[model samples]
Each structure stands twice: as C-alpha cells, then as structure tokens.
Target: MEGVSPEPLRSELDSKSKHDTAKEDDDALKDSTEAEVTKIRLMRAFVESRDPSSKEENDLMMRRFLRARSLDVEKASAMFLKYLKWKRSFVPNGCISPSEIAEDIAQDKVFTQGLDKKGRPIVVTFAAKHFQSKNGADGFKRYVVFVLEKLCSRMPPGQEKFLAIADIKGWAYVNSDLRGYLNSLSILQDCYPERLGKMLIVHAPYMFMKIWKMIYPFIDENTKKKIVFVENKKLKSTLLEEIEESQIPDIYGGQMPLVPIQNS
Candidate 1:
C-alpha cells in the first residue's frame, strides 16, 4: 500500500532542531562580540623589539609579543588541565635505564640557530622538506626532536630564556595531511583536539619527532589561557618529550607522531 502522509510530529521536530541550532549560533556571535570588546579595553599599542642590546632582553620581548598575539584560547586551556597534567620529557626522569643521552655539551647554540640570513633558523628550509616524503608529519616531528635536543644541549646554562619559533612551515600544511589530522581530532571527544586545529605545523630544518610545541587547539577557555605560543623553554622541552613518548609507546598504538594515526 502507498505510505500515509508524514506525521506532523516529525516535521515539528526537524523544524525545532534547525531553530535551536540557529539560536545557538546567534548567542555565540554575541558572546564573541563581548569578548572582543573586553580585549580592546585591556590592550595597548607597542613596538616589536626584535633587536635588543642583550639576548636576555631580546628573548623576553619575543616571549611577550608571542603571548600577546595568541588568540583567545580559554576553551583550549580548560580541557587540557584536567588530564594528568605533568610536563613530559623524551627520557623518563625515573627510568633507571635511560635512553641514549648525547655526549655533546650544551653550548650557547641559541646564538647559532633559530634565525634567517639576518639570523634565523632556515624555517622555509624546514617547511620545504615537509613535502619531500610521503610521511610529512612524521618527518617534521622527528626534525623537532633532533634540532631541539641539539639546541638544548648547546644552550648555555643559567640562560633563563630560549628561542621561540613560529616558522611559516609550522603554520602551513598539505591538504591531505591537514584533512586527516582534523578528522582524527573531531572524533576525539575529550582529547586535546584543539592542538590539531592550532598545531604549529613546524617546518624545522630537521627536528620535531612530529608533534613538537604543537598542542591541539580544541580546548576550553580557562584551560586555553595557559597555552603560550612561545611555550616556556621547560614546557617546550617537556612537551616535546611527551609528544615523542606518545608517538613511540612500547607495544602500544602503531603510529608515529608525524604520521596520521588514522590508517594505522
């Protein structure tokens, strides 16, 4: 027999869902506007002190500017704070049989790296290499691990500050890689998914194991406030370790940090 006319209840439910979605969007816009107003009131004009007399001063200025530039991250920060939040390192602090420790002494290598012709780490060189292989992410991540470790080892002791990089390579990504990363993040309910959205896809010359200084941008407000773009040197080092460790877990997920864990 032919189907009867659809029930009024079904139509009403669909209409209600769309109306609710629209109202929610409208409310979000209003909240965002208010936040912008608050931000304007708290901000002040300043110049970028790219060249300062001392390295200490130079680092501090760079740190401040990066912090100031970071967009509202209240959502991202709140969600990550709850998960066992301890800074991680590539080598476990307590592991009796430690991983291989480099023999080279930490020098004042900051003077040597992280800059361009006028003094910058060949960020573009790092980025260009991203597409050189099939596993672009994995290549980048390993590059961070290698380069940062070398930098840290070379950095002079008692230096309170270190270099912070936002290389063009870090922000740029391949279409296929980007889609895969975003998809994995969306399915993850409580994980630091924003790190995926905000991940500084670095194109370091040859460093990160895959996810270095990269946190999923998907997070809550209070938690996001803690996300510093120029991650504190300790945090940067520690996060690198954690991301690396997570990538090469013993008998765990068969996925590398730079490579998409999805197909695996």
Candidate 2:
C-alpha cells in the first residue's frame, strides 16, 4: 500500500537522524518541528472552517491526511474531503456494522493480534484463506475497510499507525487476485493513508515473488519502505525486533495463539 507523501515530509514528524550529535543545532531542529506542527494546525483549521460537523479536529486524525499528501496543505485538504465523501457514500450509516460485513467476516481471514512494543496495533491476515468470490471486487474492499476499522478501534493515545503481517505460507496462484489487491490497496493507501506502520510478509514462497513483482509497481515508494519479507526460518527473529514475543502468535514462534474474532 502507498500514499502521496515524499519520504522526508513523511518522516518530518516521526523520524530522527542518527548522525545527530550533542553539538547538533537545536534551533534548526526546533524550527523544523514547529513548522510541521503549524502545518498540521493549519490543515485542521482549513477542514473545520469549511465543514460544520463538530467531531473534534485533533492533530491525530488530521495528521493522517497531512502526512498522506506529504504536508502539502492544498492536496491534503482535497484528500481529506474526498475521504469524507467516500465515507459518506460507502458507509452512510457512519459506521460499518457487523451485519454489513457478515459475509466477509465469516471468512475470518483477518483479525487483530494485539499491540506491538510501540503500542501500534498489529493485524494479521492469513493470505491463504483469502479467495475471490462471485460477489465481486467490492466485497474485498469492504473487507479491507472492515479490518481497518477494527484495528483503528484498538488504537489508544500516542499511537497513529498499525502493523500488518501477511502469512502467505499456503498462498498460491489461485489465491492471487490482482484486481482485489489493487482495489484494496487503493482504499487503504488513498482512502485511509498513513495508517500502516510496517507490513511483514512471512513464509513467502518463490512463486509469491513473481506475484509481488506485478504488485510492486503499484505500491508507493514510501509504503514500500515499510514492507519486509521474512523467510520462515527468520520470521521469529525479524518480528521480535519490533513486536514482543508474548504478543505474537504461537505460529510465529511466539507464546500467543491465534485469537478468534469475537462477534459483537
């Protein structure tokens, strides 16, 4: 998945350089940080100024759009409006209820797997379990949004992104649906934006590499930087770098089991 932001602008708020020393210029760093904050405030004000909804325009939600567009106010505003319009049309009820996604949820292809060391939510998807159905491409998009909403609900303060692990152990040519992947990617990268932290692909077979090459060009460079491919042998070590072993599933050499999604 990908968004519109340039690499530097995307990390302006969250990343720091390792070359910095005790003699580093504090004033310049402070100024840069202040400017980013100002942009976020301006973007929030711009959106709230044109709309009448009082849902509280905090930095967290508005930052998603700002970061999505690389902090360009005009583009970010347009993206934000487009999101609101899409949400209104796609989920007119203001929320996607369980009944709306009953069919997709029944597959149990996706589920929340607790939080990582940084407090970012971890969502696991069994790619082998996902298959294209006669219901068509829209079903996949709805399922993507449903999984997103479910993960977002578990986010607490100071957390703005989530991690995803795609278990492609049994994934094959039959399970590879390019259209579904593109549509879902568009929804997440364009409609959602800046919500993905890292996407770890575990148990990726040689055949999946060919499929990845096809999908690679569609992914944004910034988003590509967030993806990591791990061999089954090294999956545990790689995941344990960012996620605690206790929070990971037993299938990945961790103590936790694959928790079932509880119906509400």
Candidate 3:
C-alpha cells in the first residue's frame, strides 16, 4: 500500500452518515457547505490516486479508510443539492441496476495477490456537453460498486488459474447539462440488438447486456451506437493515458463476479 491512493477511503461520506431528513430547505448551511465541497474535491483526488501492491492490500487500506471516518464533521448538503442540478455537477441521480446479476463468483487464487493485479474498472466516459436528470428530488444518487470473485484468467502455466473480477462504478454530474444529454443521447436511446456492439460493454455484467440487447430493437440508431462494448483492460489503460499514468484511488476491493455472456 506504499504507493496506493487513499482517496476513496478519505471521501466525504459525512452527509451520508446521518439521514438528512431536513425536508424544508435550510439556506443557512450554505456557506460552510461550499467549504466541505472543497474538501470533498481534495479527498476525491486523494482517494483515486491510491496504488497498492495487490488487491488484498488495497482492500485492507480501504477497510481502514472506512473505519477512520469522524462523525463530528458535517457533510455538505449543498453538494448533494448539486445532484439536483443535473446540468453541470458530477454526482449521483438514480441507481442503474442490472435486472439480474450473478449470485456470486468463485474465490481463492494465489498468483494475482493484490488489487491492481486483479481489479478491472467498468467505466463509461461520455462526451456530453450538457445533461440533466429525469429523476426528481426523491431519486437515489449513483455510486461505484467494486466486487471481486475468484475467477479464471487467461494465464500461462502455474498462473493460469488466476483470480480476477470486475470493479464497476458510475460517474454522474449534478447541476450540469452534461448529465441529461448523456442519458438521453447515449444510454436510453436504442433497440440495439447487440448491446455488445464493440468491446466497450464487455465489462457490463451478462444480465445488463441481455436486458440491454433485448430492448435494443426498440431504441433508435444513434443511441444504439453509444451502447458499445469495450474491453476491461483497455478502459484502465485509457484512464492512465488521460492522466499521463498518474495513480488514482480507484482500487480493486474483492474479486468481481462477472456473469459470462456468450459472444455474438
């Protein structure tokens, strides 16, 4: 864990600790809310850059990070408010669940010891200039979920029976136009039979693809194109490229249990 990022562990879950039932608006908490926003940014940058020797080490670091949280600090309600904007902010709106997913996956592999060696983030970076959420105030915000299940890897010799898994996370913008455009233009647009149009969607579990493709023929042409299938390996590499190979806190927790889909 020497070189690993601790951003995720250091994140601003302050507001989430307590159920924010302040239904009536409180404009009074506005000023300090902005300050917490700054800390969130700082902490986010810290978490995404955490690099560890192996997935196990990364997992330990994350566990520790979670335990280190202090309840004294107040979470920025304003930040969650950004989720209401949907045009420019990057936050959660509603959850995207695969209609059905694997109950679980195998575990206990030796060679791939740490998080980095076994983690694969299923990410989708859309080119949306503006977006807004259809889900109103009552909607849930999006967050990343990383799961690892013991899995077979295409390795050679003694390393052949390696374990690896999918780490899936969704990024959203709040108070931004970019969010709305992305959902409308890319995801919910099409009846693209082969949701796995390219290797882009391979990271998505089998059930998601199945439902996505099943409803494909009902969507339009342009939207279907956005539902591309990408390789897990390439997605991470691309992130590295974008940041000039800088380490971010996105670590692999456990082995991701992937639902196998037969290639079309």
Candidate 3 lDDT over residue span 154-201, tens digit each: 222122112122232232233233333333333211111111211133
Candidate with the greatest lDDT versus the true structure: 2
lDDT for model 1, please.
0.31
Arrange candidates by lDDT, highest first: which order? 2, 1, 3
Residues 1-264, candidate 2, lDDT per residue (tens digit)? 276667766586444442242124332224345656788778777777776452443455566777778889889888887787788788787666666666777777876666889898887888888788557776667777777877777776456689999888888988888888888888888877888999998888889898888889999877899999987778788989988989987777887676644331
Please give the distance, in angstroms, between residue 184's alpha carbon in candidate 3 and its true position after superposition: 6.7
TM-score preference between candidates 2 and 3, better one: 2
- The TM-score of predicted model 1 comes to 0.24
Alpha carbon lDDT of residue 23, candidate 1? 63
What is the Cα-based lDDT of residue 232 in candidate 2? 75
RMSD of each: 21.3, 12.0, 19.1
Clashing pairs in 2: none
